[model samples]
Target chain A: MIIALTVLLTVTGFFFFFATTIGLIRFPDFYSRMHAAGKGDTLSSLLMLLGLAIYSLHHFSFGNFLVSLKIIFIMVFIFLASPTATHAIIDAGFESGVKPWTKEEERAEE
Target chain B: MHFIYMFLIMFGFWIVLSGKFDAFHITLGVISCLIVSFLSLDLFFHETKKKGRIAEVVRFLSYIPWLVKEIVLATIHVAFIALRPNVKDNIDPKVIMFKTRLKKDLSKVTFANSITLTPGTITIKVSDDEFYVHALTKKTAEGLPGEMEERVGKVFKEFGE
Candidate 1:
């Protein structure tokens, strides 16, 4: 049961990551691509880490418990850091005057 | 009090990271944590006299599960948009700006990060009371700073109008 749960979580996480890559390629511009990279990267990494933490506890030992706790700590750190990093990147883009692509821009170009 | 709290937290972190409870290792952990905490206590707890801090922390902790749920929903939303055949038809990317009522710096930071984590919206900049955000779709753009502002404000007890 635990293994099943772990597999499900990890697979779902991978699926999100794949979608993020696709979004990065297909999105019209820098800022929109950031939308995919930022959100999808964070959620997928968190899910995969959560699955790893759970799977590490399958043997039920104090050492395993500590390891899982460490994984959670890393998750918390990522939770704080990822969005801040994304904000920094987007802020840099904004500062450098990178214009965001819009529907109207596409219509005008076509 | 802040010193003690910082020291304990640092020591607890050391224990978790070190994963060793032997007397020699434990003594080393204690000494290092003491030195580090003393050096950074002010940095760690700069607002020394804030009342109801424990309660505020509890409320914030309770807020995490809801945030996690929102993150999952956000990822799925992005995935759906990305996977659709006509991605351009699905997305209407635009920059939106708004004024926020959150006064506290921590609350404003929390609100911004929360916006970035949620579906289809990413915070581009925050200057004082104003925020500039980028939204992936019109639906998401229209829902700017909605309940999230109130929730973050409640966390910091900054019920600004």
Candidate 2:
């Protein structure tokens, strides 16, 4: 049961990572690409970590339990850190005078 | 009181991360946590006209699940748009500038972080009460500010424009 669940979550995480890769290549602008990277990166890793944490507890030992808790701790830290990092990147883009892509500019550029 | 609470929390995290219970390691954990708590007292708690302390913290935590759900939904939305062959038609990138109702810096930062957490919307700049957001689609941008502002405001207990 645990194996099945872990495989499912790992696959889902990879699928999101795949989508992020596609978005990075296909998206028209830097901001849109950041969207893909930020959300995909955070959620995929979160799911993968959650699945790993749950699977780690399948044997039901004290050491395994502590390991699971540490995985969760990492998840929580990532939850807070990932978005802040995204905002910092966006702020950097703004500070450097990068205008966000508009419909007309999309056509005008190339 | 707050200092001790912060230290305890930090030390707990240290235990989880370090995975060691020996006397020397434990002493190092205590010393480091104490130093951190002292150095960054203001980082732990936001001092406002504190109200319904326990209730407010509970409410804010409750909002977290809803935010996670939103993040998942938005990720799926972005994923579809990214995966579809006609990606150009799918995305309408634009910057939205608006003022939020959140009063405190903590609330403002939280709101901005939440925006970035959700896919397709990245908060670019914040000044005073104003937020500049870069959104991947017009649909995502249209109905965002009002609902999110109200929700974050509830957490901070400031409920107006």
Candidate 3:
């Protein structure tokens, strides 16, 4: 049962990652691409790490339990860090004056 | 009091990370935690008082499940937009600015981070009470600083009512 859950979570995470990549390539501009990279990456990594953490506890040993706890700590760190990093990157782009791609701009270009 | 709490927390972290129960390693952990906590006590607590902190933490913990649900919805929303063949027609990205009433620096930072984590919106800048956010669609753009602000306010006890 636990292994089934782990596989399910990990596979779902991989699917999101694939979607993120497609979004990154297909999105029109920098800011939009960031939407994919930042949000998708955070969720996918969280799910993947959570799966690994659960799987580590499958053996039910104290050492494995500690390792699982460590994985959770890493998840917390990533959860805090990823969004901040996304904000920083987007802020830099704004400061550098990279204009966002709006629907109006696309219509005007055509 | 704060120093002791800090030391205990740091020591707990050290034990979990180091994973050693021997006296020698335990002593080393204690020594490092003491030194580190002594050096950074102010950084950790920073103007925070002892009063109501536990209640605030409890409230914050309760907030996490809702945040996680929103994150899942957000990812699915993004994925839907990304997967659609008519992606350009779907997204109407715009930069929107608004004023927030959250006064404390910590509350403001929380609100901004929450914005970045939520659906179709990312916080670009925060200056004083003003926020500049980028929204991916008209629908998401319209939903700015809505229930989220109120929820975060409750977590931080910003709302006296």
- The two-chain DockQ for each candidate, comma-separated, is 0.89, 0.80, 0.83
Error of 3 at B137 (Å): 0.6
Output the better candidate (2/3) by DockQ. Answer: 3
lDDT tens digits, residue span A1-110, model 3: 99999999999999999999999999998998999988999999999999999999999999999999999999999999999999999999999999999998788989
Candidate 2 per-residue C-alpha lDDT over A30-105 given as tens digits, one digit per residue, 9 for 90 to 100: 8888888889888989999999999999999888999999899899999999888888887898899877778877
- For candidate 2, write residues B57-142 as lDDT tens digits: 89899899989998898789878998999888877888889887678887898899888877568899999988898888888788
Model 1, A1-110: lDDT tens digits are 99999999999999999999999998889999999999999999999999999999999999999999999999999989999999999999999999998999889998
- Tell me the deviation in Å of residue B119 in model 1: 1.1
Q: Give the true-structure RMSD of model 2.
A: 2.4
Taking all chains together, each candidate's TM-score versus the true structure is 0.95, 0.90, 0.96
Give the alpha carbon lDDT tens digit for every residue of B1-161 in model 3: 88998998998999899998999999999889989998998787777465987888999999999999999998988898898898888899999999998988888998998998899999999989989999999999999889999999999989787
CA shift of B130, model 1, Å: 0.6
Docking class of 1: high
RMSD of each: 1.6, 2.4, 1.3
